[model samples]
Target: MARTGALLRQAPLTVALAVVALVVGVVTGSLWSPLAGRPLRADLAFGLPSLEQGRWWTPATGAVLALEPVQYLPILVGLLALGGFAEVRLGTGRYATALVASHLVGVLGTAGLLALARGHGYGYADGLARQTDAGMSAGFLGAAAAATATLRPPWRGRVRVLLAAYPLVSLAHVGALFDVEHTLAVLFGLALGPVLLGRRPHLAWRQLTRRDYRLLASGLFVLAAVEGLVTAVAPGGGPLFATLSVQQKHEELANADTLLGASIQAVLWLWLARSLYKGRRVAWRWAVALVGLAMLAQVAGLVYLAVRHLPGWPAGLYELLGNGIGLAALVVGRRAFRNPSRRRARRTAGSLLSPAHEDQRAAATELLQHEGTVNRLAWMTTWPENRWFTDQRSTGYVAYRVHAGVALGLCDPVAAREADREQLLGAFADTAHAAGLVPCLFTVTAETARHALAHGWHALQVAEEAVIDLPRLEFTGKAWQDVRTALNQAAKLGITFRVGPLSEQPRGLQLQVKAISSEWVEDKGLPEMGFTLGGVDEALDPQVRVGLAVDADSTVHGLTSWMPICAPGGGAPVGWTLDVMRRLPGGFRYSMEFLIASACMAFRGEGATTVSLSGAPLARAAPPGGAAETGGSDVAQEPGPDRNALDAFLDRLGQTLEPYYGFRSLQAFKTKFQPRFEPLYLVFPDEAALPRIGLVLSRAYLPDAGVRDLVTLARSGH
Candidate 1:
């Protein structure tokens, strides 16, 4: 019942149409059997005869029939899965527009093709004109194709290639009249993809899915290979889609000119295409080699045909053209070959903490210790999974990664003076652009966002950092009543909050904290997130300080860690940013509040001016009854579905983690202390690059995550 409800809500138009079709099919003799025993087959199913006889409604009504019982289940599944998902992604009204528009074009198109074919006395066309075609698959395929625009790349592109190939593959094998209609229908669907996706992909598409450049090359590569199949099967050769002829037995090249050999090559194209889409270096190398060989063989065949006689001149020319196009495509898109595998990123991650990075780290440390950083999240600058980019002046550095053409800055730049920010940001952006990448700053504070905005970067509020002004701190207000009580109860339970570097902690105590952190991760049902977020290993960084809540038995109940916001001129730390916040399962409920309060007082005693509760990802940044971010934030400013895809994705992501992380709840807990709200923003060039930036940021944060880990994360809750 729930699943059915989901289907209706997702694709009301499709579900309604399918239900109507089933109802009509039950009454008409053409579908399954006639429930009403009516001789309605003549009026419903589409054919040239039916159209000529003026049964003009047949194109739409014809889809009501299952046509063949064996196909019914597949048609139903495709309609539900592809159509429903597209409708959900693209919205019901736009989905309907694509489906109806595609259907009308297909009906008129097939009619035109059949007429031309019949006039030419082609048996295939005459047979198709007389043959009845019925199904909603054409419309389904169209909607699915158009909806690819809503997906993130390289998936967006991969799905488009697969969908485009599906109907073409069917037409080649089946050679049925409706197969031709289905093939043409997909083109219309793809043509309307920009309208459905909200804008033209244009250069932006190439920029976003840099790894998918091979898809274009491989598509043409397969086209060149298909000519070989055509030459092997038919004597009159052209491109792959030329007229089908009787299979002929060829001389000399025994195995190479056989159907079995062509089939093997076709399967190899599939493997090569999949590999190329995944950015496998081996696949790119293989494609280049095979395309070279195929082009040479095609030239030889063309020369042989011309030398033997000009009998196959035109067809042979087309075959040569096809092979040339394939070779040219591979050469053009060669640089699009990015990663050998997902693991390639790990090998090239450039660990900030590694021996190989010592000189760079030492250099950066000296610079940062002198310049200091304003953004508390700047401490993530030292995370092992980062690549540093410094300007020529060496006054500041941006820790970043180039993933899928997106140069994602982990946080704000660490600079000696805030005044140097705009110049540094411009340099960073210019550097990224010079390298052919889109520059974006992720999980950065408002201070950095404003700076980037001054340099023409757009900002979107992502989360808010909770800052406790330690010099003016007090727990006497009504808002801090709950926090005070939690502290008192924690003292009664013998849960004392202890703070220090984990590396210098007692060995026995370190082991307990490790166990607690491990358990917390396993329970989250997802791979531990990195980049700005800290894990057990990150908590042990020599400079980071950890606070643990333990009882008399030294059993750890909860822990919090802080990363320093180095003081200006590299004098000393002026503030600390909360990093690792974890509590063991079944531990004291109030342990977190207790630990946070204790850390605040301890940091204050150490002469720290501020203690920052780091911003929560994808969580609201504003106080209750206010906008998310202070400067020009309106939550309802862009409420339409057209402008909400990124927000929708962010909302879903937040919900998925909310069950375990309770970031919103954590924010609420912070508000009880009357802390100042510091907004964070995702700074990028503009909306066109948001999706690509999103992908780059997700990968940077969760490098070790896989499909199963994400699935598990979605299913688990605290």
Candidate 2:
């Protein structure tokens, strides 16, 4: 009751219109009976006949009545919905004026058009001219269309699409007098909307992304299916009604063969729609070929009709034009479709293990050995699963993985020279695009993000790298109490810390490490995540160091892996990045704290100046209700805008995964080391690619996750 009261107050004009319509229907005894085929209709219905008879007031009077008893429901519903929306956006005064103006224009303009073509042998137009239609649908539709100018994309795009598609599809499949008036009314509203809203209507097709292209292709496919179904069901109707010779018209075409063909075509188009929307290459090729074939068939039909001097060539021309338009869209949107079928993708996956890829992998390793210390994640680029992108001069290379048509780079490029960093980024983008993949950089430093942003890219903070300057590090302050207690607890428990390559560790110790990691994975609902987060296989790299927390009984309580952070132009390693932390269930509670502190101390003793706890994906620290702070580094970086939708989404995602991965817990655990947070960013060139980028990121992280796993995640809830 309260909600209804609020709505009534908010939309007085809409309420008034609805009230007037209901009262008119009730007073004229048309509420429960047909308003048409009665004297009341002749006095109130608006059309060409009424206009010619000088009944100038009929358009206004008829706008309040429905043609039938059943139509009162739609009239009242439309008045409340579309009318209320327009009234809310435009206010009562402007909305009232727009409603009156649009109704008059819709009635008179459609009548004038029908009048012009009435006696010219246009069968549909002539038939509609003598008809009398009474409804407020045209007025409300126009008002809603005009109000669309006040919306923000993608809502603006969505509403405009519905508004346009309805009238057009209606006119094409079920041409009624109201359909003509509705179409004209909305067209006028769309044109007039911009003028009233103080803006000029212009197309910005360049802003459309691959996702938009896919949606367009999908919509076209559905439209084609609808057209096929309509043509099979109805003949000699609609605005593009097919005219045929007497002999051909009498030859029934709605037989088993025609219905079967239309059904198959519709099924094919629908299947293509689903696949094309996913950006499948095979689906795109099939759509292009099918649409092209349709165009070709239409052209052949037109040629045959012309050569034979048939009377219905115009019908063939309309079909050809539609097919031509569809073919053009498919061709123009070719770049958006790049995802190969699963079988083809599997075949392509073999290239990663090919001899050529091995050489690039070796070069990536070599590049990292010489320049990996530039960023802690530089060592991640050397992982075997990654594909490398080298500049033309082979000066530097970026390590990336392809997922869902995205070439997602792991970190900043490993440059042989500092000057080659930006060049490597540019080359990687070009190479990815050349291969029909969208290029995106993940977990990059502020400097790298800045370089990309300067060239018209966007950046979003995804994580915060926890860096501890070992030279200035200490475990003495009150904040260091957790570390001290953890250390003391480990000593009392007879748990010793061992650090070295896992391959160098004993067979028993390695097996124990595997058991701990495996047990950890078994405890989670989700599969062990990857991408930046390494596993046991990555920790076995002879160059990578592993830290083990073991008891006096030879049992491993917890373990950690450290990737060497090499300085550009190698000497001794300057830092170590912590990765692959795992602990036994029901084991030492302080194992993580003890292991991390010991590693930092061990690295410092070995002349390493810094130690990175590494960034936890989708986890960051920002002061309450404020921007996420990016510590003072060589380059100053600040979080993008506050309440950013993407940032909020990531935060929500982190919370969802918290129960499974404990990423946020791990981040809090890192604070015991007194590490400063450096913001890590995912940078890309276009805003439109963010949705695809998000999906690719999930795929990169959980390559083995299937539909069942996603359903499980959804059901898990917060």
Candidate 1: residue 72 lDDT (0-100): 66
Q: Tell me the deviation in Å of residue 80 in model 2.
A: 11
Q: Which digits, one per residue and each the tens of the lDDT, describe model 2 over residues 541-566?
A: 99899999999998999999999887
What are the per-residue Cα lDDT tens digits for candidate 1 across 484-585?
998999989888888999999899889988888888878876677777788878889888899999999888889999988886567788988998888878
CA-lDDT, candidates in order: 0.71, 0.80
After aligning candidate 1 to the native by TM-score, how far in Å is the CA of 398 from where it should be?
4.9
Model 1 CA lDDT for position 596: 88
lDDT of 2: 0.80
lDDT of 1 at 488: 92
Q: Highest TM-score: which candidate? A: 2
